[model samples]
Target: MRLHRGGRLRWPTIGLAAVVGIGVLWHGRAAPALPTAEVKTGELVDFVELRGEVKAVKSVTLNAPSSTDGDLQIISILKNGTGVKTGENVVQLDTVKLQRTREQQQSDLKRAEAEIEGAQAQARLQEEQNRTELMQARYDVERARLDVQKQEILSAIEAGKTKLRLATAEQRAREAEQKLRSGRAAAAADIESKKQKRAKALFEVQRAQRGIESMTLKAPVDGMVTILPNWRGRFFGANAPEFKEGDRVWPGAPLVELPDLSAVRVAARVDEAERGQLSLGQTAVVRVDAVPDKEFTGTVSDISALAKIDFSTWPPPKNFDLALRVAQSDPRLRPGMSATARVAIDRVPGALLIPVAASFQKGGRTVSYVLRGARFEERTIEIARRNREQIAVARGLRAGEKVALRDPTEEASRR
Candidate 1:
């Protein structure tokens, strides 16, 4: 080795020593081990996921028979899950009071009919009496005229008296004619009043008959009988008792449901944020919570135009209801079954994609931390599109490149 004067190191050798010192400082602390994922070239799908329940495409709900007043107590009902045929008896109400009312009305109807007949007979008799009086009055008038004619041929004193007698007979005929007219008018009015009363009684009888018929409810179609909740029965819980024997049901209240199991669909609610993405005929994959292994294909059949408030919380979130038609129906698919659906809205094939968490922002530019050897190199990446869980890289990334899931500087400092 060559030495400089007075045992000092050579200038070139001193520069080399300084370089070694910097290298030692760079390797002093190890780089932090970070969670990483490789950028992959594959198809990327953006989908909206919704949670909901299975329902029937066609469902028939049977409401309580309409009543004028008070509630209808259930006397007997079919079993909750019993299969029923069309025109079969499904429910029977307590008709004891209705029966009593019907009997009373029937008696009233008979009395009304008897009154009508009696009134008709009296009207006929009154008509005959009036006709006889009218005829007698005409005869009296003719006899008075004959007496006046005789006055012209008799003696003077007798002729004067005969004229006076004719005058009195004519007066009596006028009074009889007035009586006949008044009697006929009074009898007709009395008959009309009685007929009106009879009509009222007949209406009551018919109404009572209809009420008795409404007490017995029958199945309108063939399907399984599913009992509906009695909303009035409970006061302090989300669930209410089902309609059964001895239960009091109100008018227009749902009593039972008949769901057509041949056609099934899922009824789900989409988040308000994703409401705009839903459209008719969009396809989806549905998975039932009860049957996890199978995935059913479905298409969107209906979507609500307006949002509804979710009442489960204070300041509730808005939600939109949607119906998905299942492509195929299975026997295991029953109404009220819980299910989840994933609806694909957009897709990209053979794209460079990475986990969304592996990307970060710096200096108003999108970036990703790449693991290179013992350290992480920060690279700026251009984003093409993104979803809830993944992001598609448009530039500055290639397939098989490793990206750090978190900030490398922060993790390294902790280490």
Candidate 2:
């Protein structure tokens, strides 16, 4: 029943209209539209991508081989980017001081030679004089012995004065013997001292020769000559420029570097999140940004067992570095070229896969929508494997099923 409007029997008419309106409202409410998806079988793959750099297989910063004794002067850079053969002179240090040292050493050596000669002559002369003196002393002793013998004979004849004279003669003979022994010993000591002086002089000469040879720097291997720069614009051998044209350098300064560029390998950093999927001998596709059209193929040659921390700044950033070997190297590929690398982690052969966005969670399991006539229905599906872009459907889905592509929020608004 309904309230009467302004005419006879309006109550019955109003009640009938009310019942019809309720029926229309109830029938017009449609089921909420649900998003749907289809099941399909396809291949899936997992990959880890990282930014890398193209580098020489062997590259090193040449350090001065000698210690920093003084300001090193670059005499001359033999060849820049010039291919030098092994044993070739890459750099020439200033040999002024070296030359002066050599001259001084030569002078010292000459002086030593003269001294040795003088010592030898003196030793020979002294030995001859000692021999003469020894002979003379022996002659004198013999004469004295004869005299003592004569005196003794006279003393034996019973003359008191003759006995005293014989005693004095015996004393004089003993003194001559002592003088001869002392002269011989002094001569032997002088010869030994002279020999030692000669040995010391010879050692100094050898040392000087070695120092001179060190001034000339030679290439250790056949490679390109890269002149390393010092704080000043001059490029010298490793360590510091220890010599000028005339400056003498001490031993062991790094003066040159010979780098072999037969092959190139890239040392790249891979994030820890992707480290688990990476392994040795995996194929890598590298693209050098400098040479965009050229693609280089490589394999994972090595992986760092431990993570490296960058302590240069506060709170270190951690990363796992790896080395990728270019199977085929091009001459144009140089060190420090920016590159991109793709490392394949896993691949599925002809498996059912779908866009990751199409899959949603329902009751702790992945689910998707399946279009049913004019509406959509939610169907729970099992995910065997997944990546950021796609997921492999394991079960609860079939091929040719249509799924909604609209945003879930839009679908809810429609409801």
Q: What lDDT would each prediction earn against the true structure?
A: 0.84, 0.66
TM-score of candidate 1 to 2 decimals: 0.68
Candidate 2, poorest ten consecutive residues by summed lDDT: 237-246
Off by over 4 Å in 2: 1-45, 51-63, 66-73, 78-80, 93-108, 145-212, 226-257, 271-277, 309-316, 351-415
> Against the hidden reference, what TM-scores do the models get?
0.68, 0.58
How many residue pairs clash per model? Answer: 0, 29
Question: Who wins the TM-score comparison?
Answer: 1
- Per residue, candidate 1 scores C-alpha lDDT tens digits across 1-415 of 7665965656778899999999987865455777899999987889898989888899998877666478888898998778899989888888888888878888887887788789778878877887787777778778767877886688889878777777777777787778777877877787777778778878888888788777777888998887877777765535567888999888767888889988889998887889888799888989998888789999999999999987545577899989999887787776777898998898899889999999998989999988777777899999998888899999988888899999987776675
Off by over 4 Å in 1: 1-43, 135-153, 160-178, 233-237, 289-294, 313-315, 351-415
Candidate 1 displacement at residue 176 in angstroms: 3.8
lDDT by residue (tens digit), candidate 2, 1-415: 5555576677678999999999887556553454445667787877778787766677543444363246445566564467787777766665566566667766766776676677667766766766665566566556655655665456555455455555655565556556556755765666566556656666766666665565557777677765432333234332332223433333454444455567877778876788888999998788888778788888899999999984434566688989988877776665656788887788887778777887777669777776665456677888889876778888866778776555443566765
